[model samples]
Target chain A: DAGITQSPRHKVTETGTPVTLRCHQTENHRYMYWYRQDPGHGLRLIHYSYGVKDTDKGEVSDGYSVSRSKTEDFLLTLESATSSQTSVYFCAIRTSDRSTDTQYFGPGTRLTVL
Target chain B: SQQGEEDPQALSIQEGENATMNCSYKTSINNLQWYRQNSGRGLVHLILIRSNEREKHSGRLRVTLDTSKKSSSLLITASRAADTASYFCATEPTGPGNTGKLIFGQGTTLQVKP
Candidate 1:
């Protein structure tokens, strides 16, 4: 479990609506990541934060934004949801402060846009 | 768009048989890591092999990295039904000021028959 939890385990929303997914970790990990898993595409990074208020875009960051106001929480927001944005979202945390990076993931949020 | 590509998009084997998955990357890397995702759940980190290391083992899992060939492989010995899941390989490139960003592969769907 790694003490990571994601909110809204499942959600169904209409296109053009705004959606926000929350990730909370009790481990006080330095790095947090948001990723989406889609069929055939596997998992693609959307956004990540190295520390509080230090977020960066990932490969698929066009329609998504993220925020981290505290070390324990990271939020991923879709300004305007689209059909293509429907996917299972995962939040990961890097447990290592050393050179080697190993990420532990949360349970995930399954979002569907219609 | 993806740095790593896994071979045999899908695999099926008996519980006692060994399952092997191969991953090939496009460029030089700092490390190669493997992850497993059960259906409808988040990914779980399995093993990681740095570019400097050839092989590493954890329990029944063995990971080998070939930086010269820009490839890696994951071997699960005496596979069990619980081993059935999707496996993905991710790469982190080497350089100064590295963000430790990981580019993931398409992944391989592994099925172990009981």
Candidate 2:
């Protein structure tokens, strides 16, 4: 729905390895966000971008970085992944209008670090 | 650090019963949103309430936003087994082009037994 897709529906990796997850949207929205969901903590924003070449860190952006080089793609990279980072990663997109628009979510990527 | 937080971290109920969950946020927001995640795979946007509005309804879902108290409540009437999932509340921060960028709260896991 809304043409949002996240790569690697599921992944298993070892600690200290770098991993990059990709989010692609066919809807051509102007805003994109990356978030992680874990037990108890709910969904925490990792990063978000308002437009291409513009990005900002979220509350839990310590070990994460993001890039949006184009309108349709936003990439989230985990530098030196840790076990604590194991969680479901989600991508969201929405139009630029501030007129009560709902954010669309992708099917999420489940990452497990051993 | 999350801007919103859900209470009753977990809730269990029977089919045909009503389910209620609460969410509280720290900062002022333009609007609030509710999402449902089935099996923690993906989050489906359910409903949204703006700061200026007090209550909104969609099908069997009802959402109430108390901007004064900085809290909100979601009620699902006559919930079915399919309603078993984790529910999250998200806030759209007030700013330029802040429509789709949502800050989420920890979720409440709801288990509806059939």
Candidate 3:
């Protein structure tokens, strides 16, 4: 998984509950991203962080928030879980030394909202 | 909105044959990358082709990009059963404030039967 790990690999939560997913990287890459994969929607970026305390929204940032307080950790929070937000979440880090931007992904976390 | 769209959502081929996948994007991009994901696993970067470069090769994989057409293609020679997986094309959009964010396609599932 390219030295990236996501906690709580599988979780089943009820509606309106708060959920936070953690993504930790050993590579200390500067760029981190959170993405969700669904059946038809493919992979949609939720949010991304360029550096510590610097974050920005992606195409599907609604109902989700992200924080990067440390260089190796990026957190994705769901304020209130909903059925629509149930999907497989993946975290990725971009390679800095490579000539072309290539991303390495972490093992995904599967979340089910009831 | 999705930035990239893949052709042939699902494909079935026999071992020793060749497999090809196509991706088209909506905007100008700095580079195009291909990634493969096995079932219940994280995606692994396959190959990356810059906008200036027309073709790239890595082992048994070949990638070609057409900036004018805003499209790219991935060809796998001598496919094997172990190569059965989902392949996705991601593009890093060109322009100011580019944080190396990637927009991924829906992906094409390849089923290589032995």
Fraction of true contacts kept, per model?
0.71, 0.78, 0.85
Off by more than 4 A, model 3: none
Best by lDDT: 3
**Candidate 2 lDDT, tens digit per residue, B36-90?**
9888567888988888999999999999999889999999999999899999999
Clashing pairs in 1: none
| Candidate 3 global TM-score | 0.98
Using TM-score as the measure, the top candidate is 3
Candidate 2: Cα lDDT at A82: 97
What does candidate 3's lDDT look like per residue over B1-114, in tens digits?
888999889999999999999999999999999999999999999999999999999999999999999999999999999999999999999988869888899999999999
Provide the TM-score for each candidate, comma-separated.
Answer: 0.96, 0.92, 0.98
lDDT of 2 by residue, A1-114 (tens): 689999989999999999999999998788888989877777888899988999998778999999998899999999899999999999988753544577888999999999
Q: Given the true complex, what DockQ would model 1 score?
A: 0.77
Docking class of 1: medium
Report the Cα lDDT for residue B88, model 3. Answer: 96
Give the top-scoring candidate (DockQ).
3
What value does the lDDT take at residue B35 in candidate 3?
96
